[model samples]
Target chain A: MDLLERFAKGDDAAFEALFRQFEREVYGWILRIVRDPAAAEDLTVETFWRIYKARARFDPQAPFGAWARRIATNLAIDHLRCRRSEQELPEQLGAPGAPNPALQREAREQIQRAFRRLPAKLQAAATLAFIEEKSYDEISDALGVSIGAVRLRMFRAVRILRKEFNRMGLKP
Target chain B: MTKLENHDDVRAILKKGFPRIRAADEEPRRDLWPAMLRKLDAHALRQRVPWYDWALLGALAGTLAFFPTSILLFMYHL
Candidate 1:
């Protein structure tokens, strides 16, 4: 609580502690949305920068985690929207600096092939929950869906990921 | 014999059948402190639109648009 107060008051140490606590989670959450690590990192930094600029205005009664997630969510969505009109995949996320060819080929063949086979909703939901580590509530906010809907999507996604993992002899 | 209580085949199958899910990789940053600090700052800065605000706006708009019309064509008096 004291930490929250300090953070509310612009104490760097308090802010540092808070960042350490949620950095990966936030980054993962955004990455789940964008599906690109490099992009996610950039967005993560941007999200935190926005947080720093907006901290004083936060309501103490509100859930801080959800609040921060909202920022990252909007930013990630804005990013996706910006990219929507672009036909080709961007250069950075292009096929250039990926894994070694053989491994990449296998991984891509296995992952992308299976991914494409699933419904769009399932793919999005699974990646967000499993890969991103977002809580149900956070996913609901990010996706702008109800809690029940998020859980249902997550349940189906888990099944798909488990099935895929099993096919690859990977432990779920 | 209770189904697979002491069945080696079942145990082996169970262990072998489970799927492996690899975790996503973390970012290159050494510490999350900076990011978290930023998250708090960002959270505080939300331009939140509360439900009541919307409700009030809707009500206000309704009031402006509404006109009182209390004329009964025929009122039956007993």
Candidate 2:
């Protein structure tokens, strides 16, 4: 049997080969969503463990990369949800073109706090759609939803953020 | 302003606030295969049946063997 067939049959060597092939892509995808190297590393491992456990259900003819990405995306969304409950927001390095360092830091912090407070689905969609400038189709695939659903999440995220930012007197 | 302009404003604000997007390291610092192996190992260990559970299962079998009527009781409980 070929690699995909072998992997579906629960062959360890085949699983390892597939893991090596997709490791960087999965890790990079998760890192982009989570934006934390340490958390991304842990989530990547979790994603693969899950993928292996569910191997019996995988169709050999299907694309492995997309399957791996969907698993990684769900794990990243869960991580974000857990972090949201804890209200943890990482500090961003000061960006150029901001005249006041202290004021800029405060604004960024406020934005981060509000952004993190969004529902995990909306947060993920917005992060991929807006900040990363990823295509809607790509975001939809990773999110395991239709393009319409992704657009809805994006709209909700943007509306919530705009309201929060306006209330805080941080206009665009 | 128009709807398009409103969206652009929000997008610009988001870009300004989330500057780390530009600086994020895309590549992982280390291979994660070892970690995946460890997790699989841990799960395999967890999947092993504990002695207590096996003992309980044995006791149930013995009870059912001795009193076939108990099979009805078990089915009822289930």
| DockQ top scorer | 2
lDDT of candidates 1 onward, in order? 0.59, 0.83
For model 2 the local lDDT of residue A2 reads 89
Q: Write down the DockQ of candidate 1.
A: 0.07
lDDT per residue (tens digit) for residues A1-172 in model 1 = 5777888888878767777777877886776666667778878878877777788997767777777887887788677655533222211221312457764454444444444344555555545555444466666876667878876775665566456545554322
Report DockQ per prediction, comma-separated: 0.07, 0.35
Name the best candidate (by TM-score). Answer: 2
Model 2, A40: alpha-carbon shift in Å? 0.7
Per-residue lDDT over B1-78 for candidate 1, one digit per residue giving the tens place of the 0 to 100 score: 122233232223223222222353655345545554556555555447676887987885676457333122112321
TM-score of 1: 0.46
Regions more than 4 Å wrong, model 2:
A85-98, B1-6, B20-24, B47-78
Candidate 2 lDDT over A1-172, as tens digits, reads 8899999999989999999999888988888788889999999889999999999999999999999999999999999999985454434434423699897877777677878899999989888877887888899999999988887887788888787667666666
Interface RMSD of 2: 3.3
